[model samples]
Target: MTAITINFNNVVKLNVDQFYQLCRDNPDVKFERNQLGEIIIMPPTGGETGKCNASMIADFVIWNRQTKLAEVFDSSTCFKLPNGSDRSPDVSWIKLERWNVLKPEQREKFPPIAPDFVLELMSSSDSLSETQAKMQEYVNAGVKLGWLIDRKTRRVEIYRQGQPKEILEFPTSLCGEDILPGFVLDLQIIWN
Candidate 1:
């Protein structure tokens, strides 16, 4: 099933603490809040999507282990963006310096800082337009780089801070460039 959005703006607006509590109460559900305070209830991924997501996260983790320059996060971690939205990317990484700046308490809950890099792996239930809009939101919220990977289409949309998005068709791999030195994501596993 695709995501279902609930608009409570007209009735009640949940603060960060309330939202956190709601998430804590529902441990099995995945939810995201847009800038307008609309709660998006996302369905869990299917087996194939889960496998692909795990593979992608593993690749990032391996690269992070070697570099030690950034902190890598999986899908479960959400961030409070500067634009008043809370989002969780499929795979995200923050520079060590940026991560270190957060207080211990701040790190325990949703981080209030944007990630340096984020990757969204589209699942069967995801809406392409919605995902694209989410990627653009990440860019606007100070994300240095972002990738929206659509497995069905074998396409990758690369988002850079100040440049227009670049679309790649069936690329074998993706370079991290200056943002993540010496890191390259192998797309063969994902494409297959």
Candidate 2:
């Protein structure tokens, strides 16, 4: 689907408060705002996508429960990036210390902190270029690590700060490295 950008030339651009209110008014819609002041309205994920997304995040959830080194967030949690964009990565994690630096109000609202790690699942409706750009944005906003997984191609693009993206084809499992210490994502976990 082609995304529509709100034309600010003829229309008044929404301030952050207005944008937040607009989101609150539309409970059923998923929304995102880029640094360019463009609003992205995303269609709800299909059942298959939702299932796969759940599977993709299960490992992180369990690991966070055990180690509690970081807080894990599902797709529904929105974060305010340092660049002033509101984004929701499919699966996100923030180190415990970083997460606690926010005031209670900040934690309750869209927290103004970039995640340390982010994972994005490419749905059929998603634009691959857009997804890749979003990953780059995460890196630019200080995300230490990010992954863009394309199940159809069975390819994974790993993003690391100050490093070019590393692409892997048909990997068996993913190593979390020092960022996640001892956590591994098994490729086989994705249901057929």
Candidate 3:
């Protein structure tokens, strides 16, 4: 995939509630949180987050989605990271148990929580330092697991509680590592 400049000049500004309604009406499109406001309308075409990486990321996410390991959320969210900062991950997951805690009414309003796991796929516009900072922010926010996938290096940086960020390079497997035991993400399949 190639990097394309996103044109936000025509992008519609919407309230969080209106954005939720929009997603409910059009299940095909996804949205992201606005840097200033609480919401941003999802474009009908390619969003930067989508065009940044290859389908391998999608393949891994699709596999998880099919197995119910977790759900995939693109740049269409404004989760409150630690330190009162709000940022959206490239891909994020909510544990079934935590997600189930939400009442049907609560789910109507963005689930009102942070994700259990986050995956940040590196892009041309994002620097390594920026991604690392985002990972630390997620960890500080109490996220259980986080993966910083560097497409340039084809390496994954793993973050967990009380542990150093571990880097795994190619020819190795990306596993749940007790987080979602028995689940394996074969990097070979995606990195191929």
Candidate 4:
């Protein structure tokens, strides 16, 4: 279940449109791009991971419905990062303004903008090093806040731009802070 990275290094890499087409061609698979132009092929999550992911997405969706300040995206939505990587966070939020500025075509395709907030739920199959690096990449691409939720360890790694990562051990809940005003994620269910 380990994700594999195929480096195109020096050889011609697929452009954004080409990558989108590649994804279209392979309807059953998930694909991602790294800043280095390497392709990351991710396998589907197992049942447990899928259920947990669904719970997390549900929380975000409910909060977004109340606030209407941002748009909520699920894992299936990929973004073209400023650093040139195409990433799909487990759950992501983009400020309404940022999303509004994109052309209709851009909106239809992968939007070329970093999310304001992102969450990475660590499935048992994901490698810690690779996932952590991906979170940092989100910060570099101008994400205001990010969370790496490790259900296995019952810990959360908080990523904020221009700051070091903060780890919370056995946190019962996490407040969205200014990034997601008035929103709070209760972690008790996931911890169990």
lDDT of candidates 1 onward, in order:
0.95, 0.87, 0.64, 0.93
Please estimate how well model 4 matches the true structure, expressed as its whole-model Cα lDDT: 0.93
Backbone clashes, each candidate: 0, 0, 2, 0
lDDT of 3 by residue, 1-192 (tens): 332223343576555567568667877655444334443333342344355444545755776767786666665555644344445676677777777887887665565667887777776556688569768868877888888877668788999877889988763667776665566665654354
Cα error, residue 115 of model 2, in Å, equals: 0.2
State which candidate has the highest TM-score.
1
lDDT of model number 2: 0.87
**lDDT per residue (tens digit) for residues 80-179 in model 1:** 9999999999999999999999999899999999999999999999999999999999999999999999999999999999999999999999999999
lDDT string, candidate 2, 61-103, tens digits: 9988999899999998888899988999999999999999999
- Where model 1 places Cα greater than 4 Å from the true spot, the runs are none
**Model 3: colliding residue pairs:** 31-76, 32-76
Q: How many backbone clashes does candidate 1 have?
A: 0
lDDT of 4 by residue, 74-150 (tens): 99999999999999999999999989999999999989999999999888899999999999999999999999999
Which structure is stronger by lDDT: 3 or 4? 4
